[model samples]
Target: MVTYFEATLAQLSVHRVGNKGLNEFYSLSDNTLRIEDETLRRLLMQYFLSPFEKAYEVFRFTHSSDDLNLNELFHFSSMIFDDQSAFHNLSGQITKHLFNISNHPKIKSGELYIATFRDIQLEGELVDAIGIFKSETKESYLKVNPEEGGFALSYEEDAINITKLDKGCLIFNSEKEEGYKVIVIDQTNRTDAAYWKDEFLQLKIRNDSFNKTNITLGVCKDFITNKIDEDFEISKADKIDLLNKSMKYFKEKGSFNLDEFSEEVIGNPKAIESFKNFSREYNEEFDAGLDQPFDISGAAVKKQAKVFKSILKLDKNFHIYIHGNKDLIEKGFDEDKSMNFYKVYFKEEQ
Candidate 1:
């Protein structure tokens, strides 16, 4: 199974500082920027134009500007298009994916559990830096922040921020041999406790005992697709996007199936129609061995009456080829529920 396609490149981003003599560049709270090492902004700029970059820059500073939240940022960017879906379900392909930022935790119902260093005590040489946040809400998240001078991160008011809390903080320094301080009486559950245990383990695995970059953050995705439910996972893997296109040729001289030719993926409806009709007429005139145009009366005429023109569905990822031309996209499809043949029919201004 194919996985995620993440291309990480390290390049300098242009962040400005006032000419007052010292650097006064942007910050995430100021729009989530830094005076130096703003790699994410640079990457976004390369794909997007200057106006977009500036907008994002402004947004980062405003905090209210980002389109997606941290969990959403981590989720949508991680998946890609798949192949099996096209050959199988053949409809409603993931034309595109988007990331939406939100204030609430993406995992439905997990609040960040907060405890001050005073709340928890430390003793022996434990590995992961553990902070015991004692909040009424038993939710928690472990975020890695490099801009924080150290890898310490502190969440204030549900927003991610850099922290000065360090070894002095038990969460950042897992030197305690004893179990974590008991859960608050009001906040108690085996499931919640289990979640904390896993969080601590993942943290310890990441920063303390061993160094593993890939850590699991509890998340849930509402998988939306036109394909079968079983194939949802497969269609999201990173793979070569197979653009499918089919052309049927009909010539006058001989019934030509166009087995000798190939259709280019060039996006032009007229060019597409010209090819399909020319092939169809040519085949009718020649390949069918029809020496003359005659009236329809027999089984051949009845069969020919049902003959439908080819269809074309143009999209960002791949084109779809159904045997019959999509009169539906132009007519506006409000068809029955179970009907799954989805493709926008090219609408020409009549």
Candidate 2:
């Protein structure tokens, strides 16, 4: 969704932010780094923006007070967007804000990079974007060179691997009022110390086609796997069939209609009604404002399809992958062995 083929890094400021809980302090940069070498600039661009290529889900900054100006990052980013001259100062403020939020003892101190890019291709438009990144993990690299008759080898420790970015976010300057479209990646703090996105960014998933399709598929999966068995005497093969049908529908159709999906995927009247009720309950519980008859996101379908279990494990012996034609596979119990088994029928072998 985001491309940097023609993008150029305009400004870059690096700072060191430490964990407040550990009594560490943050150090601000005196001036923005002027990258003179074109090769290093290109590599840094790749390192910063490459992770966002597959990031399709968009997010917007939100606040508990329902005020955009109240959000610190949003306001600071807006100021920087409005006036590039204030980039260094605003970037320092952003780093200070991050330091203030690093109260958890598990949070690691790292170098924070604030960069501004130009001509970033997002969706179909070329827009400038502000990037914030932090490097938390380090690696060791060995260097070898020709020295006299033999090659000398030396190693360097505590080196930042440009390939593995720890945390990063890109804020495109397209939608200024609505918090500007944002995409983030945080690979380090995935556990309880999830302050990077939740406490620091304060972002909410944009209610777009991607989120709707993702949430809809999640609701269907939960209803079929966990809730349906409670009310209906459905077999595991039937569940797999339903899941397969759901995936097929999403893959085949560009748009999603609840009524059509119910009629096609869920044929039973009572089951369809139960599914609708369960969907409503799920929406209410999670506050997922899913709109009906919305366009289906292929990326979301592709991502959610991975988690839809199509494999049926038979004890510890065989695993039946029910992809199509549930009727071809029959479940039965052997009398002598007293063990349940699955009978699979196939037309040809690959």
Local distance difference test, each candidate: 0.23, 0.91
- Taking every candidate in turn, the Cα RMSD to the unseen true structure, in Å, is 27.2, 1.7
Backbone clash pairs for candidate 2 read: none
Candidate 1: segments with Cα more than 4 A from true spot: 1-121, 124-169, 172-186, 203-350
| lDDT string, candidate 2, 189-275, tens digits | 568557988889999888789989998999999999999998899988999999999999999999998889999999999999999
Best by TM-score: 2
Mind giving the per-residue lDDT tens digits that candidate 1 earns over 1-350?
A: 00112222211112111111122222111121132545744443232222111110000000122322222211111121123222111110100111011111221222122111111112222222112221223224566678756676765355322121111112222212222212112124445343222222212121210011000000001111121133323221110011112212211212212222223321244434443454456446433322222222222222222322232433455554443333333322446753334445455855
> What residue runs in model 2 are displaced by over 4 Å at the alpha carbon?
285-287
